[model samples]
Target: MFVLLITALIKYANVPDDIPARLAAARLPELVPPSSLLYLRVFMLAINLWAIVLKLQMIEDKVIFHSPESQLPRRVEIRLSGFMWCSFFTFQAWALQTFYLAGALASSMSAVYGTPDLGARLPVALWFAFEVSFAVAVLTSFIVKYVLIPRKVQNGASVAGFFGLPDLLMHNCNTLFMALELLFADLPVLLSHFPLAALWGLFYVVFSWGWLARHGVCWYEFLDPSLPKAIVMHSVVLGVLGVFFAIGAALAAGAATISSPYVRIALVLVGVASVARTGLITGIPEPPVGAKKE
Candidate 1:
């Protein structure tokens, strides 16, 4: 846990270093100095690190490996996960590109050498759109093959009876983590780009939850005796997510105070609400198909 905390903090902390090029290009007035950015950078790094370690440990145990009549499902899972990560990276890249292009245009009088005009923006936007579209498509495939398809053929296993304590713990935890990350990403985008914030937030949550349902968590786990324990564990995870977002909100609020006190408060409120919604998702587990209490 200690290591994970530091990891998240480090990710948050290195923001300045990671986006220096983008910042310079965007010509975004350095409202916050490099020193201030360093602090936030370290904090975000720590948050990310903590999330990574927890997810890695949880998924490592849950991901199954076997040779089956069809390797399609396994391959699809791998592909979906890979595509999600790639989408994240590409989104970051595109944001950086936008900043650089916008900055160059600000400085340049002529539309020739440095400024990225409509021509450049169009291609970058198209690429980002394609990346997002591809991610959504891949995720849909995973749902159809794994979540919606019959599982008995894999090992004569009952889809409803397959999950145990470990499965419940992993499923709930991963869902919570992913939800929070998505929320965090959306918060800034939402605030900066008001019209699209809600749309993006809805898209992310829907896609992620759909993926979970497709992976076989579509049913409730109410019949499972282990449900109580799973609830507790999930609650604990959500609590941690809440803490992380609260801190992030506070930082963002402080940085943006020059604009309006009310605005800062509103931003913080959004952060809090996002965290609460995340907790809500984990509060109940989806039942496995055909579940009956013993």
Candidate 2:
């Protein structure tokens, strides 16, 4: 069943190509080659979404809501939950990653095979925006389930706080915005889609804000909060990375494209290191409070 769904979902879809890349070329083409690598890029996106949905379903049934916990079954469930949470984090990280990937792939293809048509590019562009928004929605959902939900559990806050009314409304608004953007993409002017995309982004920001408030975080705690330190810690770490990337860019100058390979390699290494670190931390044992020494 999973294989069937994946194959069905990932089948290559028709794409338009007359993007910015073609405008820079000496001559513009009316249509792009269907076999062109750019046209097939959406298949890769479909595969990613299919995989995530499958893994999420599997994790929920096999680990998160397991009926029993004891002996090997208990140990396996614990390990699987940890693994599922890691998957959640990766899904979250893919937000910016997918945006860049999709943009770069499409632009690069446009450079190679020429642009398809204004009509074609509009649908694809709107699709790209919709994909990014979906990525945000999935990431936010994962963060809520694993981080915010767990923190609320630990902090004795009302479960209702975790699913506040405001966040729900913003979440629904973002969803509707994405739906409208895609609905009108090919049928209307390309520029018309931008408003919906912008609205989605705005609602997303508001949703994140409401998330923080619902979590009981104060503005002062933005830097370093004792409660749910992961939020602050991840922010600081990403900030440091942004700084490092900026410095690298400055040092590389115009010819810094030569260093692109090394940067890509370094990113892979960091991802591996993070996965290992998560595994190690999850493996640690937690002692019960007020338990007498054995």
Candidate 3:
């Protein structure tokens, strides 16, 4: 995460001043009007920020409850939990991506639509960074909620107790909202771009391996590449999961065309059944060590 932030900062700092003018001159269709895009970015940013705040509050509450005087029988600590970490990373990615997108759109509006702005414009590279990051964020959020969380539940893990309603809405429900937005809200997401999600996952895997090499510790147990077959098996499983998620998103988008209520219901049922079948074959993951039971 720090690496991503520093890279974004360096990229933003090096942006050429006239890049927006050049982009404007390229005659890019205002497929989405600048003002509308700005509004959407702002909305996404706000929601993601709220999610972050809620997450912090959850952490704080847990800490308070586990204080020495609380006399709690066994406090469930989630600070290092995979679900918590995944949520944190997803929120950060979404927030930063939204911020960068908002800035880029604002700059574009100023250059192309003669809208007033506070300062300089962002370069195309920064825009690309933000867009790709946003795509990665959406994919990560979907995989964590659908693949990781459900697997944990099925394996008798007390994953749900670590999160409250707000967290659930932010981490789980927001993925669905993002998918719907991509399908119905005319966002920039496309089927061809789905591979980028897998690329992001590959990058993360490499990054995690590097971190383990340096720190002699693994952030996620499943990602401990040190074991003889761990890296190979983990990489294969993640690749397959990424492809499955991408296909699911594409199918959901395609399903938007079926206007009939009964057909939609049938499609949804089929989708659920397919997910169940996959889960049964793969088996849900057990709670990580240190996960407290209810």
The model with the greater TM-score, 1 or 2, is 2
Ranking by lDDT: 3, 2, 1
Give the alpha carbon lDDT tens digit for every residue of 17-97 in model 1.
322233212111244333333343344334434434433343222233222332223322233332343223223222332
Output the number of the lDDT-best candidate.
3
Cα displacement (angstroms), candidate 3, residue 44, comes to 1.6
lDDT of 3 by residue, 216-280 (tens): 43434455554556767677656664565465455445545665645644554454343222223
RMSD of each: 15.7, 14.9, 9.7
Residue-level lDDT of model 2, residues 1-294, one tens digit each, is 212322243335333354343322221122223233344345444444444454444433222221122111121223333234322223433333344335544554555656543343433443444444533443344344445544444534334422333333222322232222222122112322333333433443444455434433222222222335536554553444334333222322322233454453344344223212121244322334553321
| Backbone clashes, each candidate | 30, 3, 0
| TM-score rank order | 3, 2, 1
Global fold similarity of model 1 (TM-score): 0.28
Name the 10 consecutive residues with the lowest summed lDDT in model 1.
186-195
lDDT of every predicted structure (CA atoms): 0.31, 0.35, 0.47
Superposed Cα RMSD, model 1:
15.7
| TM-score against native, each model | 0.28, 0.33, 0.52
